[model samples]
Target: MPDARGSSGRPRRGDRKLSGDRAGAALKVLQITDLHLRDDARPLIGVNTEATLIEVLDQAFASFTPDVVLATGDIAHDATLPTYLRFLQIIEQYHHGPKLCVPGNHDLIGPMIAARLPIDPLRVGNWVFVGLDSHVDDEVGSQVSDRDIAELVAACPPIGEKRHTLVATHHPPLEVNCPWLDKDRIQNASDLLESLARQTTVKGLVFGHAHQAVEGQSNGIGLFGTPSTCFQFEPESERFAIGDEQPGYRWLHLYDDGRIDSAVERVACSFEIDLTQRD
Candidate 1:
């Protein structure tokens, strides 16, 4: 909600191409998560993932052009090579900016890797965006591996280095109060939290898998959970229950002065889902 357009007012969708260093400019990042796409183009809980994704992308790009587009995860519901390729194709058709992905529990790393989506840390101005993989083998819950933690620690510049960092993962590191979904949060989140606490330059963490909007702080680091592109889970439900919230995405405004502003934007349309099929 902090003015992302700065004093110059909103940039025309193509006013100035954003990439590389803009040391004095505010960078816009569009985050779309839990795509839940499938090769068969099937619906999940009465919502068509592909259609909703396209709708969200169309609506988001119509509002503001982003320097970077981040997909937190669950890109594919079937984790198939074709699905991954299809997902990339759909996304490429929407926006030409940098596309970064993190794997969700439903994703297969091999296919995602084969698709060659960017997962490396990207730096724009003084900010560094790092995508962390928290996928656990054969498990719905997740954990940040020791190696990942070390790498993340190494990636953050020292306090006086003048570089701020933003980390993204598929699983939320903080509890969102939805007991059923909270159980699937990063199991070793304390390790992530403690490591982040020591790095003065680490600013925030963006993640998905909760299928709801969330904002919180832990150990001095900001935490954000974006809603799914498809149906959303009830934010405060104790068990598995779908909510009426429409499909949505999160917009992140990273300022040059180490300030971060973000807000969740929901699409205008809503889908009717079968409440009996709870999974």
Candidate 2:
């Protein structure tokens, strides 16, 4: 790893802020996905979605200061207008930076659009973040149209000049190995992949909907799936079941040189869950 030391051979000021300096010069990013927020009276699989979202945000506020915040999707549980507004209000409480978003199967796009929530390609600290809505009608599966793909490609700047690119979506572009969950994986991932292939600057793909923390790669591009702020799903299971994990979020430190450091932070609280009831 190149040292964070100045050309004079002395350690830089922010060098002491990070441990060992492997992070180099990077953007500290906080990502909270799959909020699944609903009314105060309603709960998703025995967990109060709205309350848990607050808990997760509260924790992130104390621990991280992201140059950008990505709310990947499923922001609304009931797909109601109020839920979307509430989600926006809660997010605005702490995050003042770029808030990028994409819609999941449970999200109602029209209402979100009308509310003026963030959903644009954001450029920050030499990196461009592109959001793709994978919400497909009548099917839990998502599709990326050729037009969507073209827009994503067109929005990307020259790889070396722009630093890097990160693509955000609501659906996992590849199978997660959980049979039940895999069925809802992006049905037209080929469109996404083909689009990504055209943009060589892409360094990361962050998504939600699996409701679990997952890390892997697709054709050497870094792939990440974040856990929900509400609950989690068991990974690699044949059937749908609630995971034992508590509410959590993922954080990323994106370096200007196309290198990224990421991790999953499990919340300090564990609420009672009725695992027998499947979502």
Candidate 3:
């Protein structure tokens, strides 16, 4: 296991060392979201999401083998136990690094807890990764709970060797300019941002479910929404629309000095997409 240590190389408590990653090196994290894996043999929006996930995983492992992997949300499209179990299995086989996940509106939390799936912050080296559950049951829009931020502030301080933190949720706090999708975003984002502003240790936030890539910053903190590993939604569109872009994942490099470098990488394979479908 590789743990981030202080300048003196002393390990901190409550932090798990990442396996297969070297100490003192920039922590490599891979973010895959909106897998929408289903137990049945059905293509989502005219695309085989499971097959696309495999292709994206293949590229992720081949191009950037990360020390930690974060699955943001919508892991299971049908919200069934079997789908969740299969997702657990796939995540186990997809990456050898540490795994942390949060549920989306499509993912039922009760079943996930019943199955004993992992849902907690992953502390690796100098940074702590907090997984926030912003999913509103039976609702399209989501909001963050103030408690999640409080727990993060208590667990990881904003200064000293543990000054860096990254927050991952299933929903983006800000709108991505797409009117159809923007209506279903985190409605109470200012609360989350206010908390982050007070706790300056949190350097950035990442999310899934938008099906588009958005990179921006607010109050000196970075904000990002990653593309799905399956089908993508049209960006900046006023109505629901399908996109022609390929599936992809986010590659993040977390430096020990509180810097986060990230980008979206699409799979290099052809997909059977139905661009006409819009919802």
The TM-score values for the models, in the order shown, are 0.88, 0.87, 0.86
In model 3, the runs with Cα more than 4 Å from the true position are 1-24, 274-279
Candidate 3 C-alpha lDDT tens digits along 1-279: 111133554322111223453424688888999998887877776777788888888888887668888889898888888888887777778665678889988888987777666787778888888888888777777866677667756765565555588888888777777778878787767766767767658888889888888766666667778889998887768897778777888878888877877778877656566655322
Who is ahead in TM-score, 2 or 3? 2
Error of 1 at 29 (Å): 0.4
Query: What digit string (tens of lDDT, one per residue) describes model 1 on residues 1-279?
Result: 111122344211111223545433678889999999988855677777889999999999898888888999898888888998888888888778777899999988998889887788888778888888988655788877888898888877767888888888999886777789878888788877788768658888899998888777676677778889998887678998888888899888888767777778888666679655333
Model 2: ten consecutive residues of lowest lDDT: 9-18
Candidate 2, residue 171: lDDT: 87
lDDT values, one for every candidate = 0.80, 0.77, 0.76
Residue clash pairs of candidate 2: none
| Pick by TM-score: 1 or 2, better one | 1
Q: For model 1, what is the error of residue 23's alpha carbon versus the real structure, in angstroms, after optimal superposition?
A: 14
Model 2 local distance difference test score = 0.77
Per-residue lDDT, model 1, residue 134, is 89
Instruction: Write down the lDDT that model 1 would get.
Output: 0.80
Ranking by TM-score: 1, 2, 3
lDDT tens digits, residue span 2-94, model 2: 122345543222101234545447788777888878755666677887788888888877986778899888887777778788888888888
Clashes of each: 0, 0, 1
